[model samples]
Target: MPPRSDSDNVGFLVADVTRLLRAEMDRRITAAGLELNPGDARTLSHAARCGSVRQNLLAERIGVEAMTVSSSLDRLEVLGLIERQADSVDRRAKLVHVTQAGEAMLESMQPLAAGLGAEAAKGIAPADWQRFLDTLKHVRANLTAARDQLRKENAAA
Candidate 1:
């Protein structure tokens, strides 16, 4: 297939939306005293979701280095938001788990995320909203595939 023209391509739109969301999230998190960077927030959220995730797997899922994940986990542990425990299955490896504080923080961030979504959807029609969501999912899938392809190419190179 032919490549899309710059204007026709959805990349710019996706990038802009991502940028805006990050900024809004940063603002809200700062206000809420989470004091976390985007990467930290994402890591914490992942830990919260997985209950207990392998360190390497969490890093792979986040598309970051294991070292970065380790550092973030250290900071989170210090903050009493997360803990690392020996993996039950593989006694040699450690798994990440969110503490009660982390759960509370995640819960607190929900309303802020909802408010941001509501604000973005303001004045949009119902049909348009559905289409918007569909387009977003499509974009997400496309980007995920691209990321996986890039990782493969990088490994080969």
Candidate 2:
């Protein structure tokens, strides 16, 4: 095969990094007795940060489909880790808020997760570290823009 393009190489690198990071996070969280599947943990974390996000917005923020978010929320609510409340402004819309139990779990998981992130970035020069962050942000923005464009086109169609 011809030499890979920059985009191809970057795609492979991103996949590799994502897998490694996810594995590490899963190990740490499992060790802490969280027992959360990746999706549940991610949803809970988002709820923790956003206070109470609209169901659709929470799905978008976590990069999952609305149905997936709803299912995850169902499990979380059943486990007493989250609660859904009617949005006063839009009675039709529901908001997801983490329960006290969820907050405590998130707080307990913070130190291990934060330390893992720090260790992962260790030894990089400050300038290079900054650039790495910027590049990742740029990639995410590009993907988000592309996704939005596609959504608009689909709606038009």
Candidate 3:
């Protein structure tokens, strides 16, 4: 078989879309002269959405490296966007929460994010759009399960 094109592969297509979305978000933040970059915005957004989540869990949910999330959180904390408190159950781990300032910032960014989503789905009908989103969520759940199983198998080996 001839070598496959990157645009024709599921993994490559997903990565391309993700890169485009993030790049647009980065551009909007920079254009707005926001103090935080895309990385910090994402970290803060996740914290606000998840509500007092463990750092590792937030990193896992965001699909980023632990150090990447940690670095973002550090910058966000300095900017008063997020705060890390000692986890009550896990002594070694910290729980991250978005501050009021973070929420305000997120409120300001929400319109931009919604606009991006709308732009991404511009030509799609409402029914198809919801179905597509549902499909993506299902695919994500399956992939997460597969990843967890792989990790368990690797640990056992």
lDDT of each: 0.85, 0.87, 0.90
User: What lDDT score goes with residue 62 in model 1?
Assistant: 78
Which ten residues in a row are the worst by lDDT in model 2? Answer: 3-12
Quality of model 3 by C-alpha lDDT: 0.90
Tell me, by TM-score, which candidate is best.
Answer: 3
Clashing pairs in 3: none
lDDT of 3 at 110: 86
| 156: Cα error in model 2, Å | 4.2
Q: What is the per-residue lDDT of model 1 for residues 29-127, given as tens digits with 9 covering 90 to 100?
A: 778776576668878988887778999999988778999999999888888889899998999999898999988878878898889888888999979
Give a tens-digit lDDT track for model 2, residues 1-157. Answer: 8975675588788988888987898788777777677678888988888887899999988888999999999999988999999999999999888889988878888998888878888999888988999999998999989999999999999
- Kindly list the per-residue Cα lDDT of model 3 for residues 123-148, writing each as its tens digit: 99999999999999999999989999
Task: Tell me how far the alpha carbon of residue 121 in candidate 3 is from the true structure, in angstroms, after superposition.
Answer: 1.2
The better candidate by TM-score, 2 or 3, is: 3
Question: In terms of lDDT, which candidate is strongest?
Answer: 3
